[model samples]
Target: MSSSSAVKRLLNYAGEKKILLILASIFSFFSTVLMVVPFGSVYFVIRELLTNANDISAIPGDRLILCGWIALGALILGFICLYIGLFFSHFAAYQILYNIRVRLSKHLSTLPLGYFTKGSSGAIKKILDSNVEKIESFTAHQIPDLVSAFLMPLIMIMTMFILDWRLAIATVIPILIGYFIQAAVFSSDSGRKAMEDYQHSLEKMSASGVEYVRGMPAVKVFGMTMDTFLHFKSTIYDFRDWAVSYTKLCRRPYMIYLVMLTSILTFILPVGVFILSGQPDNQAFALTFLLFLTVAPSLSTPMFQLMYLGGELQKITEGNRRIDAILNEKPIAEPVHPKVASSYDVRFENVSFSYQEKGDQEYKLALKNVSFTAPQGKITALVGPSGGGKSTIASLIPRFWDIEEGKIAIGGVPIQAMATNHLMETVSFVFQEVHLFHDTIEENIRMGNRNPTRQDIISAAKLACCHDFITSLPDGYDTKIGEEGVFLSGGEAQRITIARAILKNAPIIILDEATAFADPENEANIQKGLNALIQNKTVITIAHRLSTIRHADQILVLQDGEMVERGTHSDLLALNGLYKKMWNAHLSSKDWGLQEREVHHHE
Candidate 1:
C-alpha cells in the first residue's frame, strides 16, 4: 500500500468516531495556543520590567497584575486542555484499534480455508496480537502528540513574527535546516534497511519464543536441557544487536541537528544586537531578541517530537500492510445461483485438484479425475494406503480446498454453491486429531449448538458412549477439559469430539478412523456409540482396520490417489481384489489371536 493510502486508512478509522476525534483536535489546538502564549507573555513581562522598572506610569500596577494573572491562567489552561486532549485522543485511538481488531477477526472468519492452510499460525498470531498492539500505541500516544508538536511550533513562530519578523525568520532557519538533516538521515537506503532488518529480527524472535515455549515439553522428554532452548535467548540478542546498530546510525544526525540549532541561535543573537545597537529604535530589537530566546526551544520541540513519532509511524505503516494483505485476499468463489441440496448423498464428478503456492509455478495434483458417491443414510467406507488422498478427499467435501476441474455435490447441488456456514452446518467431521477448548465438558459440547440445554448435552454424550465416563468424574458434565482437552485420555478426548459432532447433529458425518487410537475396551464402547450415532445419517468412514467396515453399504479401495475398486464387502470379496486381500489378512490376525487366547485358557 502507498504511504498516502495508509494515512487515508488511518484517517478513516478515526473518522468512524468523528465526534471524539473532533473534540480531541479542538482541545489540542487550544492547548497549543495556550502553550505558545505563555512564551510571549513571559518575554513581554521580562522586557517591560527591564525597560520601565523605574517609571511609575510606564508600567502601571494594574497592568502588572493583569499580565501576571493572564500568564498564570494560560499556564493552568494549557495543562487542562492538554489533559483533556490526551483523554479524548486515547479514547479515539483505543476505539479505532478495537474496530480494526474486530474487523480483521471477522474478515479472517469469512476468508477461504485455504488461506489459513497455506499461512503460518505463529506469523498470523504475531500480526493480530503484537503488531496490532504496536499500531495502537502509535495511534493512541504518538499521533496526538505529533499533532500538538507541529501546532505548537507553528503558533510559536507566528507569535514571534508578530513581535519581530527578522528574529522569527532567524529562529525558523535552524529548524528548517534540522528538519532537512533528519530527513536526509531517514532517506538513506542504509538507514531504512537497518530499521527493516531490526523489525524482521523482532518478528523472528517473537516467533521463535512462541515455538520454543510450545516445544518445551518435547524438548525435556527427549532429554534436551535448558541450553537447547537458548535459541530464543540468542534471537533476543540478535534483535538487540540490530537495534543498537540502527541507534548508532541515528546518533550522528541527531548530534548534527542539535549543534546546528545552537549555532543558529548564537549567530542570530549577535546579529540582532549589532543591527539594533546602530538603529534609532533599539527597543524593538531588545524585545525581538527576548522573544526569540523564549520561543526558540518551543519551536525546536516539534522537531524532537517528529523524530520520536517517526519510528512509530514506520511500524504502523508496516503493520497496516500486513493487516491489509489478509483483508485484500480473494475469498473462495461461490455459485451465483445456489442449488439447495435436499439429501445427504455426496458425489464428486470428474474432480481434479492441484495445490497452488505463492510465487511457485509447479503444481502438485493431490487428486485426479476422482469420482465416487457416498449414498445417503449408509456407512460408505474408504480404505487407502498413505498419501492416497484419503484426507484430501474428506477436506474437499467441506470446501477446504477448491478443485481445479470438476464439481463435488451434496444430493444434486454443487458444494461450491452452498454457503460456508451452510456446508459446515450440514457436515460433521471427526478427525484423528481432536481439539477441545479450555472449558467445561458441557460448555465444549454446547459450542456445537449455541443454546443446547443440559439434557441435550447429556443426550449427545450418551450417544457417544461418553456420558457414563463423564458422570464417573467428580464434576460430571461440568468437568474442565483443560487446554485442548489435555486432561482427557486419547480415547476419552476422541469420544468427547464425537459427542460434540453428535450434538451438532449434521446430516452427513465423516469419521477418519475415529477409533484407530482406542484400546479394545474403549473401541468396543466407541463402536457401539458410533452405531447409534450413524443410524439415520449418511456416513463416510476411513478405516485402517478392515473388520470395522465389513458391513458397510459400500467399500472403496484406493491406491496412489486413484480408486482401484468400489463395491459392497461381499461383492469385493467375491472379486478377490484389494478389499478381499485386506479383509482376509484382518480375519487371519483375528483367528490367530483367538487361537492364542484359547490355548492360554486351556493351560
Candidate 2:
C-alpha cells in the first residue's frame, strides 16, 4: 500500500475524533508562528544596535529588555501549545488503537478454526500487539511533528525570502538536498525491501522463540543444546544479520543528512559576504548577517524532525498494511436470515474437503465425498487410524470448515444456513486435547454457561467426578489451575473439560477420544458422566479404541479420507474387513498389556 493510503486508513480509525487532527494543525501553526517571534525580536534588536553603531550605549535599555522578555515568552508559549496539541492527539490515538484492537479481535473470532491452526500464535500475537502499537507512533507523535516540520520550513522560507532572497536560496538549498536524500533513503526499493526483511526476521524470531519455549521439555529429555535446536538458533542469527545489515544501510544516509542540516550556515555565510561586498550600507549588511547566523542554522532543526519522521512513516505504513490484511481475511459467512435446526440429527451428503497450505497452492484432502447419516438421539462412531479423516468428519458437523462439495446438514437444515452462534450452541465438544484457562476450577467449569449458579457448577463438577479432587485443593473450587498455579494430571484435566461439556449440554455432542488419557477407573467414571450428558442427544464420536464404540448405533470406518465400511460391531466383525482387523489388533494389545503386568507380578 502507498504511504498516503496507509496514513489515510490510520486516520479513519480515529472515527469521529478526526476533529482533534484539525485542532493539532491549528496549534502547530501557532507553534510555528510563535517560534518565529523570537527570531524577529532578535533581528530587530540587532538592527537597532547596528543603527546606533556610533553610540551603542545610546540604544534604549528598556526596549532591549522588552525584546528579550518577548522572545522568552514566545518560546515558552510555543512549547506549551505544542504540548497541548500532543495531549489531545495522544488521547485520540490511544482510543483509536483500542478500537482497532477490539475490531480485529472480534473479526478474528468469526474466522474459521483452520486459520488459527495454519499460522503461528506468536506471529498472530505480534500482529495484534506490536504492529498495532506502532500506529501510536504515527498518530500521536508523527502526525503533529510532521505538520510542524513542514509548516516551520514553509514559514522560514517565506520570512527568509522577505528578508533577502539570496540568503533564502543559500539557506533552503541544503535543506532541500537533505530532504531528498532522506526521502531516497526511506522510499527506495532497496531500503523498503531491507525494512520488510528486517520485520520478517523479527517475526521469525518471535515464532521460533515461542516454539523453543514450548519444546523445552522435549529438548531437555533429548539432551539437546542451542546449536542443535536448529530453527530457534537460525532465527536468532537471521535476525541479528538482518538488523546489522539494515543499520549499515541506513547509517551513512542518516549521518550525511545530519551533516547537511548542520552546515546550512556554511553555504549562507559565503553568499552573505559576497552580498556585503557591493553594499555601501554596512549597518544593513551587519544586521542581515546577524539574522542569517542565528535563524539559518535553526531551519535545519526542522529538517532533523523530517528526517526522523521518514523512518517512522515507513514503519507505520507497514503496520497499517498488516492490520488491514487481517481485517480483510474472509470470515465464515453468517446467514442473514438464519435457520435454526429443528432436530439434532447430523447428515453428510457426499461432502468433500481439502485444507490448502499457505504460500503453496497445494491442497491435502482431509475428507473426500464422505456420505453418512447420524440419526437423532443415537451414537455414530468414526473409527480409523490417525489422519484418516475421523476428526475431520466430526469437525464438519459443526461447520468448522465449509465443505468444497455437497452439503452437511443438522436436523435436515444445511449447517451453512444456520447462524454460527446457533450452530455452535447445537454442538458440544470434548477433544483429546483440552485447554483450561488460568483461572479457578469453578470458573473454568462455568465457562459453558455465562450465568452459571454455584449449585450448577458444583453439580457439573460432581457428575464429571472431579468434585472430590477439587475440594481437596487449598482453595477448593476457587483454586487457580494453570501455569503459575496448581497443576492437574491428564485425567483430572480431562474431567474438568468434561464438566464444561456437561454444563453446556448442547443437543449434539462430539467426543474425540475424550477418555484417551483416563485410567480404567477414571475412564469408567467419565463414561458415566458422558452417559448422563449424551442422553437423548445426537452424538458423533471418534474412537481409537474399538471397545468403547462396540455398542454404537452405527459405526462408519474411514480410511484415507473415504468411508471404507459401515455397520454394527457384530456386523463389521462378520464382514471381516478393516473394522474386523482393527478389533483383533485392539484385543491383542489389551491382552499383551495384561500379560506384561502378570509377568511383573510373578517376578
Best by TM-score: 2
Put down candidate 1 lDDT per residue, 1-603, tens digits, no spaces.
444565567767665675676677788788878876666567767777778868847876676677778888998998898788888878888887888889889888877678887866767788788877876776666656877877877777777778777777777787787778877877677866775676578777877877887898888898876566677778888898997888899888888887766666775787688777788467757766766765576555576777777766766776787788888987777667766789989998888876675356776677878899998998888887787778888889988887888989999888988878788899988888888888898988887787888999999999988999899876888888774443888888888888888899899999998888889988887787777778799999988888788889998888777888889888998888877778878888776743334334554
**Residue-level lDDT for 527 in candidate 2:** 83
Q: Candidate 2 regions off by >4 Å?
A: 280-282, 357-361, 593-603
Candidate 2 lDDT by residue in tens digits, 1-603 = 777787688668888887777787778788888988887888888888878879978998899899999999999999998998898789778877888899999999999988888878888888888888888767888788988998888897898898788888988888778778777877899888987887778788899888888899999999987899999999999998998988898888788878888899899988888888878577676687778888887777787887778678888777777788789989999998999888888998998888874355687788889998999999999998788999888777877787888899998999999999999989999999889998989889988877888899889988888889999988989899964557998888888988998899899999988887789888887887788778899989999888899999999999999999999999999999999989999998887743334334554
Candidate 1 TM-score to native = 0.89
Q: Which stretches of candidate 1 lie over 4 Å from their true place?
A: 1-7, 53-57, 185-200, 225-245, 261-264, 277-281, 357-362, 472-474, 483-486, 569-603
* Root-mean-square deviation of Cα positions for candidate 2 versus the true structure, in angstroms: 3.1
